[model samples]
Target: MEKKTYIQAFCTIENNKIVLNGETVFESENTGFADFSKKAYQHFEIGYPKFFKMDNLSKLAFLGSELLLKAQNPNDENNTALLFANKSSSLDTDVKYQNSISDKENYFPSPAVFVYTLANICLGEISIRHQLKSENSFFIFDAFNAAFMADYANILIETQKAKNVLCGWTEFFGEDYKAFLYLVGNEGAIENTKQNLEILYNK
Candidate 1:
């Protein structure tokens, strides 16, 4: 029999709050995504110094995955897959980079800022942190396409291309941002399905 996929763990970040497995772990009054993410990182005692250098979008994605994978760290990083999606893509960083070069007077496009102008950069950051060297992809949509993510992750697992799948929707634009990440494995409380993903994402 084919192994059944389950949601091993999940995390949600929005409204300056971080929720892990339906439990509120971190909340801050900070109005901006940058501040809120920093607070959560400090609260969690995440020691990765590189996190401080990431842009707002990468910070959001990193924190969300960090919380979700806290307890369920993968043993086989090579067989783990990362599937992520968002609505805004990299508009937030694009604007910042554009502004840096737009002014001839300034003419200062920081490489640090330019590096994160692509939405997939967050995936690269996460993979580097986790040492995950497996299949990875990023998608952009008008809204969270829970069905596609669920089905695609299952396909990875079913084909034996990946033993585990870390997937989510992380959207960041200015002060408005949200990240919902979940780990799919062969055992857990909730089955990995589109409906369950949508429900968890909504919750």
Candidate 2:
């Protein structure tokens, strides 16, 4: 018999709102990402100072992961793989970084901003926070590929490469941003399927 996996919990953040397990946990309508994320951080009372130092994309992923990981921490951090995808792929920060060094007269490049130029950096932030030392990868797709994500996570779990898989799409670019993160393990109410993933992602 083949081992089965399920989505234990999921969180979504977009349109200035944070939703976890089908509940609107936090939201700020008139605020931008900076203010909204800061307020969300405060509401959750996440006391990590490094959170403020991260770029927007990292901040977005951090907020979503915080809810899921904290809610039902898988206990085995060493084997929880992180698989995240995004359409923008750090272009948001790339644009900002470009502006910094674009002006030859100004010629200013910030290491802090330059650090987040890759989308996978968000996974690094999550790993450090959760102390996860398993496999992790960041994919850049034109759109959310639920089928691929489902397959990849299943392989990781089935092959025993990871005990639990943190998977989702986290896209952040300027005023537009969306994040959907779910935990895949041996137990949960929702089965890990492409169709189910699409439903959860579209929901």
Candidate 3:
């Protein structure tokens, strides 16, 4: 019998740096989903699917899923998505969507932009992209809550709602953006859990 080493992880934005898998890929320039997508495309070598550029939240969701899927246990199917965050709640798209309604000359809701008004849509996009149907939830908070995140994840696993969980905070502050994600599971490969999440935001 051996004590297992779990690798609980997170990605974040800081000092104009985009931290992903603990590596800084881009800097400054008001990075958002577009920047995230470009950097992700460069880093992963897999081009984004055809429709990513069509929507802001979809792009963010795609990026989050890409990171979480890499950390997921390939053998596990019972996985849940838990997201936490605050601010704007897709204000980026809301602004764009408003124009469609505001213009009396051709007032029409852009379904593309309208689809992202709810912050939780990001989760749906990710789930669909990954074919993940396990339990999923979204929470809005002023800051990251280590205790709540840990408890929720543990509950999901202990109750058999899922064997693994993808928990995260994804946000866009106008042109600026930040995202932190983790894969939590009973499997022996993830580490740090709540402590790792603290390091991400507290940094």
Candidate 4:
């Protein structure tokens, strides 16, 4: 018999609001992503100073991951694979890095900004924070690929390559941004299916 996989927890961050498991855990009045994200970080009381250094995309993904993985602390297993996707694919930071060198006369490029050019860096941030060292993957699609995400996560679980998979979509480009993160494992109230994934994502 095949083992059952479920969505242990899920989180979403967008519209200056942070939603976890269909509940609004945090909402900010700030209008800008930067300010709103920072305030959200402070509200969570996350002591990781490195969060402030990450690009906007990383910050967005990191926050959503933090909420989903908070009390679970799956770091003990060290086998939680990360799977993330985004439509913008780090364009927000690419634009920033591009502007730094756009003017040859005032050319100044910060390595900090350059490092997060890839969407996968957001996964790195989550891994570093949780001390996760399992196999991870990131994808770029026109929109949230719920079917692919569900199938991919289940493959990892069924293969026993990972005890659990932390996966979702983290999209941020300019002021437009949205992050939806979910944890997939052998135990939970919700089954890990494309329909359920889309339902949680749309929530």
RMSD in angstroms, all models? 1.6, 1.2, 3.9, 1.5
Q: Which wins on lDDT, candidate 2 or candidate 4?
A: 2
| lDDT (Cα, tens digit) per residue for candidate 3, span 3-68 | 222435556654446566677755545454566566665666655464354466556556656765
Find the 10 residues in a row with the least total lDDT in model 2. 70-79
lDDT of 1 by residue, 80-153 (tens): 79999999999999998999998999899888898999999999999899888889999999999988988898
Which of the predicted structures, 1 or 3, would earn the higher TM-score when compared with the native?
A: 1
Better of 2 and 3 by TM-score: 2
TM per model? 0.95, 0.97, 0.79, 0.95
lDDT of 2 at 17: 88
TM-score of 3: 0.79
Once fitted onto the true fold, the runs of candidate 1 whose alpha carbons sit more than 4 angstroms away are 1-3
Clash count list over all predictions: 0, 0, 7, 0
Residue 83 CA error for candidate 4 (Å)?
0.5
lDDT of each: 0.88, 0.92, 0.64, 0.89
Clashing pairs in 4: none
The TM-score, computed over Cα atoms with residue i paired to residue i, of candidate 2 is: 0.97
lDDT of 2 by residue, 63-171 (tens): 9989888876557667899999999999999999999999999989999899899889999999999989989999999999999999999999999999999997999
Give the best candidate by TM-score: 2
